[model samples]
Target: CKCPLGFEGINCTDNIDDCSNHTCQFGVCIDKINGYTCKCHSGFIGKFCEITSQLKSSLLQNNRTEILSKTCTPEICSNNGICYEDSLNRVQCRCSPGFIGDRCLMLKSVHANRNDSYMKLSKPKIFPHLNITMIFSTIQNNGILIYFGHMGHIVAELFMGRIRVSHDIGNSPGSVVFSYHTVNDGKIHELQLISIGQNFSLIVDRSYTRFINNRGIRTYMNTSEMDG
Candidate 1:
C-alpha cells in the first residue's frame, strides 16, 4: 500500500488529508515522488509543517478559538498598528508616519515628512505663520467651490488671479464658503490665518462646496449633546 501524492504513514494507505486533519489549514499538501509534502496554507508553514507564516497574525486573533489550537505564537505586527495578514501568509503593518516599531510602540523619526510640503503642520508656532499656496484650474462649465471649517476664529482671503470673477467669503471664522463664476478658465489663491486661541481647523479645497444650514427649520433639542 503506497501513500498518495502528499500523504505518508506506513504503507501509503493513510490519506494525509491536510484539510481534514487540520494539518495544513493555510497551505496545500502536494504529493511528491517519494513522500507527500504538506504545503501549509497561507499564514502557516513548516514540513508536516505546523509553523505559522505570520508572526502577529496569531497575536491579533488571540480571542478566536481557531488560533488557540495552532502551534503558532502571537505578536506578529511589529508596529503599534493593527496586524494584517496578507494572502501569502505574510504579516504587514498599517503604521503611522512617525512611528515604526514591531508593535508600533517604537518611534522611527519624530519629524518624518510623508507627503507634499503644503500639507505639513508641525509644533505650535503662530508668529512665523504657515503659508500654503495652491494652483487650481478648471473649465468654464465646471462648477468649483471651496469649503472649510474651524473650531476657533480665523480669517480667510480669496483671490481670483484669472480673468474669471471669483466669489469671496469675508474674514469671519467658524465656517467659510466661496464659489467661482464668470470666465471659462481661471486661477484662485486662498490664504487662511489661524487666529489666536484657536486649536484646529479643517480646510477642504474642492470644486463643489455644499452648505446645509438648518437655520429656519426647527428640531428637538436634547438637554445633553446628541449622540447618534
Candidate 2:
C-alpha cells in the first residue's frame, strides 16, 4: 500500500526520513514544520514539510526594530504569521504565499503560489528560477506584467492579449518567449511566468509556452524593477 508522506511500513507505522538523503541536498534537515518556515536547521516547506527546497542563512531585517527587543507581537507580522527564530537567530514572520520582504508584508500584486519562496532581489545572489502567479482580468490588452532591470532588464507583458516575457543576462542581447493562449477573456484568468538564463516559460491556465536559447541561463536572474 502507498504510505502517506514521511510515513512507511505495512501498516504505515514507520516514518520515512529522507532528510539524510538527497532530500536536504542544499539545506539542513529539520523534522519540525512551521509557517514563515524557511527557518532552520534548513527548511520545511508547504503543509506537510514535504518539499525540500534550498534555504540558507539570513539576517533579521531591520524593519523589525522590536525583534531585538525580545518581543514578538501579532502586529509585527501580517496575515496571521507566526514569529520564529531563523537559522541566523534573527526573528522573522512565517506565513502563506504571495508576500515578500521583511515581515512578509509586501503582498505581490500578482497572485502567487506557495511554491513561490521568499526572495530578496536586492541581493546579487541569483537562483535557478523566479516564480510568481496572479489571477487578473482587464479590458486593456497591453501592459507590463513585471519588470526587472539593472545592467539590463527582465520583463513580462500582456501584449495584444498574449503574454510575452523577455530577459537579458549581464550585458548580453535579450531573448523572449510568448504564451500559447490569450487571456483577454472576460472571466478571470491565471498567469504565471518563469524567466531565466536563455530559457523561459509562460504558463496560462495550466497551458505552457516554453523557450530555450544558446545562452543557457547561468547566474541568478537580476533583481529590482522599474516603476514604469
Structural similarity to truth (TM-score) of each candidate: 0.20, 0.41
Residue 107 of model 1 has an lDDT of 38
Q: For candidate 2, give the lDDT of residue 13.
A: 72
Q: Assess each prediction's global lDDT (C-alpha) against the native.
A: 0.36, 0.55
lDDT tens readout by residue for model 1, 188-227: 3232222222222323343333332212222211212322
Candidate 2, residue 33: CA error in Å?
46
Candidate 2 C-alpha lDDT tens digits along 111-142: 22223322234433225556666667755588
Candidate 2 Cα outliers beyond 4 Å, as residue runs: 1-125, 214-228
